[model samples]
Target: MSLAQPAPTPSRWLRAALPAMFILLGVIYATWASRLPAIRDLRVLDAATLGTILLGGGLGAVLSFPLAAWLLAHYGARRAALYAGLGLLFGLPLLGVLPNWWLLFAGVFVLGAASSCFDVAINAIGAEQEREAGRSIMSMLHAWFCVGTFSGALVGSAAAGLGLSPLWHFLLVAFVLLLMLICAYRILPCDAPDPDAGKKHFALPHGALIWLGLIAFLGAISEGSLTDWISLYLTDHLHASEAGAPLGYAAFAGAMLVARLVGDRLKDRFGARRLVAGSSLLAAVGLGVAIAAPSFGVAVIGFVLTGLGVAAVFPCLFSAAGREGPTALAGVATLGYSGSLMGPPLMGYAIHGYGYVFGMALLAVVSVFVAVAAMRARLLV
Candidate 1:
């Protein structure tokens, strides 16, 4: 049905279901993120302490990757997704109800593992669908994820404003997400592995997958930095009210939402090679703008630009990894995702030591690597 894809074929059910899974995953993540300020205030943690806690998440993700790949190999993407999705749901409530920071850290760590494993499952399914769909569908799929985040963020802000507890908010989100998962399960591939699929095993990154993984790593650092920091930055630096703190984050996700909606077309027009290079520089400029901005309002523009700039990178990189091979995809995804999960803690340490301005500027400095990688990465795919 698509103009550019080469494929033996993929199921219509899979093509239809994977995008919803992407959205559901985003909702799961954003809901927790939306309520972060509440948790911060409740826990009374400083930047350094919070960074330490967030590091648990990165560790969890690292632990989960091999397990996730094994699950995918033995049970297939569908079962892996459901298993991790449930794990994530179980942890969301713990984040709100934890008695202290140490327990919270443990809970977050578990959630982080669930998050990455879920991501791997859906992305593997997405890659399969993209190959079947021909042209570029990855961006559009991720766009749904953005949309879910945007909705969750807005809901979180409203919930905070309405005097709802984080515990209650998380429960409500979990219920909705659970329902979505129930629907998704009916349409996804069964637990049995596909013998003909040729990707039953996992391997370390090799050849082009290495370059693609590097590209994924670089871009993810920028993305993770923004997603984890923007809301807090709006509050601490700009003195925005708690209810309004999420606006900046919303702007960031909204820009990504719009960009990815259009990303497939852009990819078609420009190709991943040239497009990613320009996008990296654009993100750098955007970060610079946010860092130099005189007001919260102006900084939001920068966030929007930053979001728009990096929106296409994941879709392109992941799609290319899929093209390389399934084992390569798993390897590249783990490393690339490692970069994203690590960004928050790294930036947390930065902001703790220096200041918010310096922390943001650090992101700009990091983008330089992304720009260089983007240019060089074209040939690898």
Candidate 2:
């Protein structure tokens, strides 16, 4: 490694800080999401009004991703992450204090924008650092994200169960996250401008890059659909106990977490494309069982299979995106994130019209398509 070769092998500080950033982002976003019902009740808003308010975040995410690409190209991933991290720090407290409709709208929008910026920047950093290190660490980094989500959601869920104030709960979580961000900023490696960054600011992903994006889209929507619909399907369609309905999703998430933690080794053995295509089929089969069996035991098994199946997908796809160029990766990630955000509602509408079984079946169909696509694509990895 030369003196100018991007800090050979990634410093220990960077390895630690990158995952910490992921944890912080996950905790912040999950904590906020878990408290939405409380926020709705406090504001005395109907479902429609609340839905509109939540849409602010989605709108903000879509609008800012292109800007995130520009920032990554011009300022580099580290600075991009730092700037976006500030958005998270400031936005967390604002979410707690919004008292009026307009303020609520603005608050969510800001928080959404901040989260999206951080999402883009941090993933860019993860991909950058992984390339510099010459191996597969994206899954490990993403596992920390899952860990943070679980930790934060558990804490928030416990707090809510205890009837804690949402405002106070949010503020405390924000304070802790703020501290984490400061430490990460202090120790992580700095960034330099991309010499290759020319007059071009953004490039819509084409060729193999578009295939990667499509795969990301499918994987994300499948994951999102499972999270949103699992509980409802379990209780409504499968007749699981109220307390037990959540176990289906718990199974799914837990399996995915475990798979991601071990995914790097599996990728080393099987290769990413094989892992992706094979897992997509596994996920499809699991979802097929959920559609066919319609029993509690089978449902749990299905969820587990689905989770394990797609666990390595996002990290794998993102790794391929990195090879395609940062701008192209940005486009790919934006599309994937958008699918995650939109997939739940779309699945919900389908469930409403036909049935929960129909929705799961739809995802099963999509998973098969992803498998076919994954088989065809020429991935960089």
Candidate 3:
């Protein structure tokens, strides 16, 4: 099980296909966020109610992780991934068409559950692939997610510009995702988890894993806060034009994508602990710079810095989770995902009560906590 062992290299097509699937997932998921206004108008739900309903998706995702692990163990990673992708194809289009808040909520919940299951299974498979390849590949895998988000945002903007309905936009994207999933089906591994892995049950997170979960939670909070509110912050606090406001998030995402693309080399040279620690500190500095800047241009620089700082943390955390034990990796990943789930709503509440600048400042403080925790965990490779 040592990662040092020489293993067969994956084909170029497989490497390319894997990231493409992740990108497709990101594009499909992000389409909903970009069209939030349309969905709200269609469903006639207020902000508060909408937030509450969105929590159902998080709940469903959390609940599904254990089952996902069991399925991966029994049915194998390929089947689990295929089922999850099919679920996305089935569930994503409903968001565009659902006319009622209740139906939209239910659809989102199922989508979340299926997506979470897919996430764990795919990560496990990807980690295995990386181990076999004898190189660090996780960061690039996540980079594709950022790439997908970027693509989705661009598509959303195009649709908005054209005055296209959300349903039509999503339908097109869903068809594309369906086709991509079909194409990637063959390269996905059918390997099952080891049989003697023991009884699987949902249990509360404990030990170093709990600490790792907290680190992930704090890191996610920083990331989620920026992604969810950076645009609003630019508009409300910096007085940037609506068109310019999204630049904050765009800069962040672009920087993150760049960092992730090169992160494996960085990790190989510096180790995960150093990288995580440096990233947290850089993120904190970025937040501070953005908050204190006098102009939107400077704030954009800050956003880019924050993105660079945050880019590699997720892959490092996921790799650590996998190394903790194959049997426990799903539960750990679930905990991490749970942290990510909490970040958006909490940041929303913070923004509502304290204003966007203060909320981001709070996130900067949390980023410091992530640095300290990463140092304490000492889980770097």
| Poorest stretch of ten by lDDT in candidate 2 | 1-10
lDDT of 1 at 239: 89
What clash count goes with each model? 1, 0, 0
Ranking by lDDT: 1, 2, 3
lDDT of 3 by residue, 17-94 (tens): 678778876786557656665565567765455656566566777788887887777766667777888897878877
Candidate 2 off by > 4 Å: 1-12, 36-55, 93-108, 196-198, 227-251, 288-301
Candidate 2 has an lDDT of 0.76
Candidate 3 least-lDDT 10 residues:
1-10
Weakest 10 consecutive residues of candidate 1 by summed lDDT: 1-10
Q: Which should have the higher TM-score, number 1 or number 2? A: 1
- Report how far residue 254 has shifted in candidate 1, in Å: 0.7
* TM-score leaderboard ranking: 1, 3, 2
List model 1 lDDT by residue over 37-107, tens digit each: 78899889888877778777888987888888888877788888888998988889889999787888899
Best candidate per TM-score, number? 1
**TM-score of every model versus the real structure:** 0.93, 0.83, 0.87
- The model with the greatest lDDT is 1
Compared with the true structure, what per-residue lDDT tens digits does model 2 show for residues 106-205?
7877876777778888888888888898999989988887777667656766676677777888888988888888778666676876666666656666
